[model samples]
Target: MPANPQAYRPETALLDLGDTFWDPVDAADFPATTLRFRNDAAAAEVGLDTLSDAEWTRHFGRFAPLPGTLPQPLALRYHGHQFRQYNPDIGDGRGFTFAPLRDGAGRLMDLGTKGSGQTPYSRFGDGRLTLKGGVREILATEMLEALHVPTSRTLSLIETGEDLVRGDEPSPTRSAVLVRLSHGHIRIGTFQRLAYHQDEAGMRALVGYVLRQLYGEDGDDPVRLLDLVVERTATLAARYMAAGFVHGVLNSDNINVTGESFDYGPWRFAPTWDPAFTAAYFDHAGLYAFGRQPEAIHWDVMQLAASLRLVAESDPLIETLQTFAPRYQAGIREAMFWRLGIRRFDDRRDHAVVQAVERVPRATDTPIDRFFFDWFGGHVPADYPDAFDELRRLLDPYTPRKDRDHPYWHGEPCSMLIDEVEAIWAPIAADDDWSRLHAKVAAIREMGAALA
Candidate 1:
């Protein structure tokens, strides 16, 4: 009922950077608005949970500006490498930053849209998103967050009265729009855009803006910025590996400057510990496969360094880039421990546990999440293979974070593999039933609390 929630803090930080970053745009006037999904939990973080369904639909579904947020949407501009190929023309073709605001913790966040409408970067295609695509993103973000992977949160999904034809899915699929909450939307390609044009001043200004707003730093040192980005990026890759997730696209545009994962497309969890597992059908080369995700992200980080080269010396950038490998390795070790619910010991012992964790799954073709679920807190299940003996011994000295008594750990571990995703979507597409989807989300949240 309140016009402005007491906890919400609207911000115009992105606008302060000026027009060099984005172009103001209007949201699409949809034929009909049908609210499909609402993330009340995420809304609560931003003090918008008290809104009635009508108010929520008005603000998100119809693109009505939040009370004190951006008066109009801004279609962001940036360029990225698409599967190792440089693409200078691509930007937010179908999405725009709708609101810039801070959460309850005062952390700067952006409410961005997908399938909103065409922009300068729309090119020849219609700016629309498939309903199934929006659903997939919701599942991806939920599972990743439950697994403790840093990622964007799906805020809302609304069905627009239109059918879309796509090459990937069955034609005449339902269309919808998605809103996501992210720490920041500045991608590495954002810098690449400035570098491609040889715009040193824009690069400097962007760097300063990123530091001040996202990281809370005040300096414009690109090298130092690159270092921080590399650390977060490597850790993100490590966490993805730990969670058995393959982000089908690791292009420069998809890699956020803040290192938080966003823009979920064709993402999947590996059913088994197979290195060659890939999520996207179009990825013939497996460049972004499950095991090679670390490499792909590292390559992206290199490209980020190359973009910073326009303003800073290359030697220090290269040196900072070198730290990515060790940080990634250490990150993997830490992530493995976290998943296993074990307190980390020294590197030698921790490395042994990680090696055993990695080896046992591949050797036995074990389900990734199930393996962690069964062996959580180092309690080796009766069915655990003898190959896990080494890991069990390594886990002995470390303290366990949780016992197997939690109800969530009692049955089959919740997984979001491709087949399960299709099962969850089948009813929604055929009969418009969303019960399974809702139930799955509740189960995942329970898993997250158990893990926490």
Candidate 2:
């Protein structure tokens, strides 16, 4: 049964909060706009699946707040240490929270934009996203969600007819506006922005608000918050490893308060389990590389701990921060087992199994997804390949979570390789042939459903 949209209260509550953490803003009216994508599946959760294309555009693209939601848009204010260098001048430069809504469980969710327009933090840059950029983000979010990573869902993509020049890609490319549906958009940087101003009241207000809106509580204990953040960050990093994903950027500003992943820029799933493989072209130091993701995310969690000092003592926060490493290790083990589709087994033998599987990939430099596709859930065949002999033997002591007869077990995996992504994008970029892109999205969703 469809949930009553009015049972959702955050949309009204946020509007009543009256721009405490954000500034009122208006969307840039664009030219020759056309809706390019709509996530009906995600919208249905909020009872918005019935919205017509024009209605979706009028609300999402034009920033017209939905009925029973916020009355206006808000460009959230924030500051962050970009690459460990303190940067006070950062916030929602190109995007804003258009409105807040609730899912079936009545959990608060924000429908925010990525290329809406310039805010106070725009500095001297153009506040527009390229059409290709939006498409890449959609692919990234979809693939991550399929891998069971708590990630954002790209709700809509609208091409706003504009020719933009950028050094990162080919100049005079297409432009777009993107809307993402997620648990919340608040970040460690959000609090850091307030701490920079030494606004104690603001910090306390934010802590309380985040606890209530996102965490389902109103407790103001910053230490408890830090603990939750550490655990969530650890689990998030573990999931990234299991999925062979490198987020590319692990800045505090990019880390969502709810621990879900969003802002998919310069992200990639590893072709091979190479620790040093990086996604961003300019990430010369590999600061946010594949294996170093746990380190990067741990650092972000600590920064969040630092911000909590405004309302709590540093000792408890620091003590909670120390849990990140051990939590991350445990998280890795759990996620690794889940990926293999095994819930219970001999722990010692499971360790051996994990080592065996990892050794095969490391030694052969094989694609990580291939291993899962072939041997997931401890499915071992008599004719198994020689490379996985150790893995197969290790599986002898294990049991799968389900019967190994699921249709997904017997085929070439639906891989989201970068090459394949480009193959899908080539037609769209060259001849505006969206058929391939549409097909890829459908295939990816099917693969996700099968895995689920």
Candidate 3:
């Protein structure tokens, strides 16, 4: 990692341009701020590694504006389709892009907050996050990152001195604000908002910014952008399938322009290989279920293509959108290989290796997480029930990573199963004992490092 160590190379790229994509909003000061979690890895990415706990709390927890960053956070504006219904009353109601800074790799990143406070978009609800929700997000990102999925990592979690009332959780739960570190906060909904109002100039400006900031190598052709987004979104869906994870909300607003998965809410990992596994309780039709993720993402990229029609013709966009199926199939095969720590030996063997994992899960009662853990690193234990015999032949051509010797590889896989997550949080909720939470986070990170 290379970087300038002193000050943040902050930019006012989006905010400086005024209210085209976002509205300047001030962060609300919490009554009392206590830092609950800090991501040192993310800190080093930007130039905030050496900041003391007091300083971190002052800036992130207290909502104090960064010295070299934006004067105020930007509450982004966007319209999205919620469960296939057009919803215009949606935007960054509770969160904002607090800062824009660069990393060691010189890629622009956003420090965004959730539960910071209410904005103009906040209709009638309080812009507060339950401590439970914050904890869940940390777990979601930690586990997903370890599995090599493109995702947002939690940077800071601070408990505010307030009790938030949530319908999904126990009443008057502890309130908290969360900051996440990610590549970009620009969403598919951003383009939709522009298109909704027929803001052709705004769409062009946003598209230009994305091309310059993210896909610099790709020329600023709208069709090329559509192609890039389709490929990425396809890969993203494949990763979710390979990881056995379900992002409960597949709304346009939840989909980011960078193709990095963020805004983890009601997320869950499948206990077993079930196609109908739905993460959100409100998903009555199973629209965003595990099996339908690829389809949902296909729909989303189409929406982006529709938005891009302001700059390009429909024929190229339609042609590019059709590539998602083949791309997704290829991506799933690739992701499976990465998860198992193997490289391609031959086309037959590679196909057999991927098929073994998919076919074995449906043929047996083995838990999905356990299936990957037991057979990962090219070691197919004998007890793996109903596993295809061809998998053994596939393993012969593959060499496992030496890092498999880690103790985590031998036991019941360190998993973020729903029961396990609840158990980890039970102590913190009742006794104010955060020992379990800390231990769990450490274990998750260790699992991530070893897996990577």
- On TM-score, the candidate that comes out on top is 1
- Cα deviation at 48, candidate 3, in Å, is 1.2
lDDT, candidate 2, equals 0.82
Candidate 1 residue-wise lDDT, 221-312, digit = tens: 99989989999999999999999999999999999989999998888899999989998899999999999999999999999999999999
Model 3 off-target regions past 4 Å? 1-4, 401-403
- Reference-based TM-score, model 1: 0.98
TM per prediction: 0.98, 0.95, 0.96
Candidate 1 regions with alpha-carbon error over 4 angstroms? 1-4
For candidate 2, report its TM-score. 0.95
Best by lDDT: 1
Global lDDT of each candidate: 0.90, 0.82, 0.84
79, model 3: CA deviation in Å? 0.7
Worst 10 residues of 1 by lDDT: 1-10
Q: What lDDT does candidate 3 reach at residue 10?
A: 74
Which scores higher on lDDT, 1 or 3? Answer: 1
RMSD of each: 1.1, 2.1, 2.1
Candidate 3 residue 115 Cα shift, in angstroms, is 0.2
